[model samples]
Target: MPSLTNQDWKDLEDSIKAAALTLGYDEAVWDGNGVLEVEGKDWEELTEEQQKAAEILGMDEDDWDEDDEGLRYEDVDWNKLLPEVKDAAINFGYTEETWEGDGEIEVEDKDWDELTDSEKAAALVLGYTEDTWED
Candidate 1:
């Protein structure tokens, strides 16, 4: 994995934390050892999408070590992982508004490709599209 800038690290942390929370974890903490410690949920009980999110974060249920307090991962491409995490979050009641705050005009004037994933999520949640947003 490439060295993460502070902001990049924060974004990745926030994304995973959000996913964990949506999937019934009470808390998600990075252990400073390339592992994320998640509390308040069992790995076997996660929904398929939630499991997918966990896998994206490098937590493989099949190889989970019962003796460890955290799950390990390496070389994670956070860009690819984020969408899956966001999808899991969305299914569990998180919305773009949850990340971007409540507003009707946030998506306005931004082209579809220029919008961040959260913005696109907001647009979709609000029933708007590339063409329809201008209506």
Candidate 2:
């Protein structure tokens, strides 16, 4: 992967914080190891009214794991992703195939301006900025 400058890291961190806040997190803290720890209520922690609101929005306990904890963001192994997702990631410059093995993958350089709309949408699903390609 290409080395990110301090400013790049800061911008990425800011974006992550904004996203976490938008997801109803009370706090978002980077652990300095490429992990973001966020404080937020789990499904079980919600009040009755909150639960009803979630239900109204089509959310249910089945949407989450029984042992679910607060949200935490971390790097994903590209090789572990579904084939379609891996293809999208590769198309968007988030991952690349390795020389060895039957196409193992790793993170690659990202060029936000070069991505197509569909690739950008895929990147967004992978927690990248949706407006990176926007003017």
Candidate 3:
């Protein structure tokens, strides 16, 4: 593959942000560094196309397979979430240092209303829903 020019990178970034908004994120902004600010979402919450854009921006490089076309949600190990996201999850009572590797954070007995807005955002990023606690 040919190397991407600066314009190519910018266009790709824009495309990813557009895709994220289309996928239900209220906002998707790149910090021009490695962080992506997606309103009410996290790495786990991102769809495959969204994640691919993140990869291009250099987040979770180890999670991607060079041989594959792109990373799929199903292929991700939830325990391997980005550091910042994981920290938020831990603070939100989603998991601990020894996560269970269930592909989702433990939320079987937690109440959604009890979780603060920030906590709820963390939970949502980890693929939890209001119905998740009920289930």
Using lDDT as the measure, the top candidate is 3
Candidate 3 residue 127 Cα shift, in angstroms, is 0.9
For each candidate, give its TM-score against the true structure: 0.28, 0.31, 0.34
Whole-model alpha-carbon lDDT for candidate 1 = 0.45
On lDDT, who's better, 1 or 2? 1
lDDT of 3 by residue, 1-135 (tens): 112222223455565546444533322122111132452365576678767665554455344322223111222234545666566557665444334444554443458887678777766655556765445
Candidate 3 local lDDT, residue 61: 35
Total clashing pairs in model 1: 0
True-vs-predicted CA distance for residue 135, candidate 3, Å: 1.7
Off by over 4 Å in 1: 1-18, 24-41, 63-65, 69-135
Q: How does each model score on lDDT?
A: 0.45, 0.42, 0.46
- Residue-level lDDT of model 2, residues 30-119, one tens digit each, is 211222222135667666655554454335666532332311122334444546655655564543434112454333243666666876
TM-score-superior candidate, 1 or 2: 2
Question: Rank order by lDDT, top first?
Answer: 3, 1, 2
TM-score of 1: 0.28
Better of 2 and 3 by lDDT: 3
Best-performing candidate as measured by TM-score: 3
